[model samples]
Target: MNDIGTILGNEQFARKQASFGPGGNVVPIPRAKKNRQPPHSDTDRANVLPLPSTNIPHRTQSGLIPAHVRVLLIQKNTEDRHACRNALQQTSDFNVELVEAGNGGEGLHLACQDAFDCILLDCSLPDMDCLEFLGRLTELTSGLQLPLLKLVPPHKPELAIEAVRRGIHEFLIKDEDGHYLKLLPVLIQRMLDNRRLAHEKQQIETLYRTLIEHIPAITYIASLQISHQWLYVSPQIESMGYDRETWLSNPDLRFQCILEQDRTMVERAFAKSCETGELFHCEYRALGRHGKLHWFVDEARIIRNHSGQAMFFQGVIRDITDLKSMRDELETHRYFLDQHVQSRTEQLEKRIVILESCNTELCNQLEREYLVCNELRKANNLQATMLQAIGAAGVTVEESFIHPET
Candidate 1:
């Protein structure tokens, strides 16, 4: 009975229990604190527990599957650092590239320069306190979730507790015999998986917020429930002289502000959007708090569920009062301009006909003038011929009398 009890509660069994994790097949270590004995001498190695057999590490986190994980090991001790590097590199599942930083200051400097997949920070750094370094590292990340693991000495469980209180994801205790190094890769894998999921979620939220804020319009999510409740309204509600909180939970405020003449049209359009799960654009006038009629345009679409059912209406509403006024004024100017152009065209047509008549009379008068000038030229030519003939005959008669006397 003594032999059986001793075998069941041996150091080998304790080691096995201590190494078990939630993911590993081995049984987990109990939460109750227990005294740890000094390392056994080599002569007792005949009864030492064999290391757990693992073909490939179960290091994968929930959402991430990295081909190579970058690990920055900040350890002042050379032997411990070497053990950690070897364990990480020997992992068969994924490649680990180990980087060493001797002190906390250097670690902080290194951390700020590049984005690492996992950081193995020593809880007792030489240059600065490990807690300070952690805080500074967190500040530098600017709320970014990077997989960081703190390396604590096995003797100081209080430090580990404090790190946990300060929101450190996980911590490690360096084992002098290098047995603890084997667990590093699995811990890193788990951290990375957790970080990936957190990052993806934050990314989605940021994208949605940025998209809604940049639209320069009121982004809305309307519920189809009683009074057509509003689920959300963007900060642009200030443009309508209303607070964001008041309109977010209330539905009738906006409708009450709509001009009585335009309420039915807007309501019908809103109803159609709720029914069809299709948000259409529409323009309507609403009375402002100052008793001025403002024009607005609503454009939206419906959010549907997997069952092809309408869940809610999501869309943007914009103020188009200036545009509407400009369009109406342009139409008025166009109408007046059209009438002015028609009247001017008629008057110009009448003047053109009178000018055409004057042109015809001038043409006839010019033709008569051209004919009279031709007749005058003929008369002048005939007179000139008569004068020449008279002169020539007088000269001929004188010559004949001179010749008869001879």
Candidate 2:
């Protein structure tokens, strides 16, 4: 087999030999001078013929070439070879390389060697039928991230459909006017764009998975209107007694998993939130797979579309059963303390009233005793005054009698 370098070298040698003669008899051809146009001039337009309007809807002037695209052309016809070259050259933006393979076997060999941006597969080859080629190609590129475009004859539309079913990106039919070549550039651009988009999507999915794995709370996205189906659930749902498949398969099963008493309140709050497009927050008990009940406080907000219609809800659920139990205990203690304080206050007031009544009776008794003592002292003084008067009068009479007798 001739390598590319050897083939190019041989072609250059043949061209040089054809230009000379054995007896020094040579044809003189003038070398054309290279044209140097002004920098402001439209130089590319001068170098290449413009593609027909039907072929390229718009001309690109951005001068940005997408990253190099590897193309595998598996057509055996010479016309197809020329047409493909013309199409690639007209693109002016894609770096397209042609790897010509005569049969599907050879094509599959090339496809397995390296990753390609797009594979332009000729459906009919001399050695293999289109179906066999597609089947083998499917197996070859099954795990690959590349896109494939199959080429087929115009009469067989059925093959195109089958090709699509086999995971081919798109199919093109070779026509008489070579219009199929025009579609190649557009197809190439689209494939590259799709590849870039696929890469970005994969990256986003990876980031989402990583975030869901490490986050502490249970996170999910659920539909707002249709059965409240869970579109996505974090890995934490497994710890909460539900897997992603189980949740997605039956959304109402989640309500059944909730404790019967809390189910009604949770459903009511959820419905209100969906209707009002407000934040939903509620504490509910979830029945685990083991029949143990765990409390969770769900906090979610409704997501709305551009027309202000509720689309879905996204949020987190936190375990708060312990906190709730503690709160109830604290409330009970507070109630007991309040009752005890109130009873003690009533008892103290009654004792104060009884002490006041006893003090008033003691004051009345002391007043009576003081009045009786004053009366007794007055009577004793009166008796003493009367006795003194009587004694003085007796002494005066005795003194008179003694004087008469003498």
Candidate 3:
């Protein structure tokens, strides 16, 4: 068998077309400077042309291609269908999965059953023609979910444009010498790149949705109305007195969550921020649906236009009931310490005054006792002098009358 027959086991090319030798084998043509254009045909006609065989296998399978890339090939010709499968598997970057269909009807059946990275359609099919298949398939993937790459006849410019308008990714012209086989890998690679980008976009959107549902704080968008109406509320709003729907739809309900004592404080800060278009922050108490009062930090900003008109309010509120409880407990402790210190200081001042008075009285009593002792000493000295003098005089008298002086 020749290389063409080996590529797809195609025997029609051997009988219908001529090759080089007397044995009559089909020669693989060189890559043409430019692929030959199709003979004059209606551009609006079907996309596929009758070529070789209609014998599609029950399920033609190959070694597993990469799980990352999957392609669906709907071609009736055995040669073209297998040719696409082989080229896609050989791609260096993609692990390509190629599912074949005998006709457009079979292709549609497989497409609806499962999802793929892309769809490759031959303009012609045996059961359903290419145009009908494309129209119906486009309707199936209306949101341009699955990218379509069509293999069209070389000169069908009109049909190609229509296919694009219907949201086909690109229409690559077909060649008779099988040159499109080399281009097929590249086209599918482009389609896969686009598909990956779109897949990432969807993932990001899903992530945002999940975060909105499970976040720890309440996020909201509200209009600056007298009722403090909410426009949008996150899932966490359920912790506050309302569900998301009730908070947004019932404007008066949100205000009801604010305690009567906190209404003035919250209103002042919120109103000031709205008027100034500044970021707002406040701590207030709220009544939860569970009949519990909780503290929250209301932080938000007034979104405004260039003209300084308030457009809306966007903000987050974190539950701070634990923090508030701690703060109040600390303040109470501080006040108690101040009172205790003041009482101790006053007691010490009173004791110091009593001690100073006792010290002054003790000094005065010691001075008077010293003065009394001095007077007694002076009187004793005078008596001793008088007695000595009297004894001497008596002695002189006694001596004259019988030694009495002794």
Candidate 4:
């Protein structure tokens, strides 16, 4: 419901919509004869609609439009500059600030400010060649994406093709009646949108790199081939005493770092996982810089395609030297505990055997004593019978009890 001002603040917006008249040409509209309204303040200019085109730029869900899109118009022809300005002035929605430069030198100078979002470069410049200017601009914004729309004369379509071949972002054909001016805003908006998208993509990539670089482990992507070509390796690889470039360039460098004793085991485990599309996991000792042996736990999963064919490996290697030290220390303690318990068990078993032997010896001695007492009792009974027989014969028995000790 925002009222974007009509063209020139006098004509109705619908009047600017012209149809094809005769021989497939846009019909010209007559200007309204009404007195123009006074210039609007800055606040009113903020809501002006962009130049009308089939593709109208929509405001984002935040209901916010770009503050202003600064354009560097590099054209020496005063009439062309006036035409471009008049076309731009048609809208008030997204403010289009145009800065005119009569020659390539001034344009390049203005471009150095790095303030403009897009550039309108004329193929024919009075002072310098457009290509040379573009080259210098490229140098100025080496890692940046700036949209440059080249304006080509309708007669010299070859210039547009040449500029495109020479790396111009986009090109527009100029006609005598200035019909191409109608499409100017659309092309500029498209280029601006593309530039915005490129900026966002670069920011996302930077954020991803920052996260990867600061992590505790080395993350990598490797090809599934036997050579195991590395696609990407995190900057954390430097902690392992190898630079990222060295690790990525030389596929065998990782294996070379592994200790001779553990190299075969790690290789076999990795190969098996790669062949079977299984998870790869192995712990091995590797020689770091200055012959420092460190333990590392490497784990990876086989990334497969939709057809179940292995594609590559996405993996992480953690420096487990400290963790391995603690684990080995615990194992040593456990081994000593086991040894101590075994020795204690053997000692207890020996003591039990000796006690059993002593108990058997005591049982035998008690049985022998019982037999001797029984014999003595039998002897006493015999002596008593003899005494009774002697009493019948009037013979006295004296001290007839036989003692076994005697």
Give the alpha carbon lDDT tens digit for every residue of 185-207 in model 4: 66777776665665566666667
TM-scores of the candidates are 0.48, 0.65, 0.54, 0.65
Give Cα distance to truth, residue 305, candidate 3, Å.
Answer: 12
lDDT per residue as tens, model 1, 209-328: 778777878888777775777777777777777777776655688899988898899889878876666657788888766677788888888777999787767778888888888999
lDDT of 2 by residue, 89-171 (tens): 65545456555666667777766664455778887787888778777766876645356777777777788788777777667
Better of 2 and 4 by TM-score: 4
RMSD of each: 16.5, 12.8, 14.1, 13.9
* Location of the lowest summed lDDT over 10 successive residues in candidate 4: 1-10
Instruction: Name the better of 1 and 2 by TM-score.
Output: 2
Candidate 1 regions exceeding 4 Å error are: 1-203, 326-351, 392-406
Model 4 residue 392 lDDT score: 71
Candidate closest to the true structure, highest TM-score: 4
Clashes of each: 0, 0, 9, 4
Q: Which stretches of candidate 4 lie over 4 Å from their true place?
A: 1-67, 91-93, 139-144, 154-167, 175-177, 224-226, 259-278, 302-312, 352-406
| Model 3: per-residue Cα lDDT over 244-299, one tens digit each | 66667777776678899988888888888877777899988889988898999889
lDDT of 1: 0.69
Q: Over all chains combined, what TM-score does candidate 3 have?
A: 0.54
**lDDT per model vs. reference:** 0.69, 0.68, 0.68, 0.72
User: For model 1, what is the alpha-carbon lDDT of residue 261?
Assistant: 90
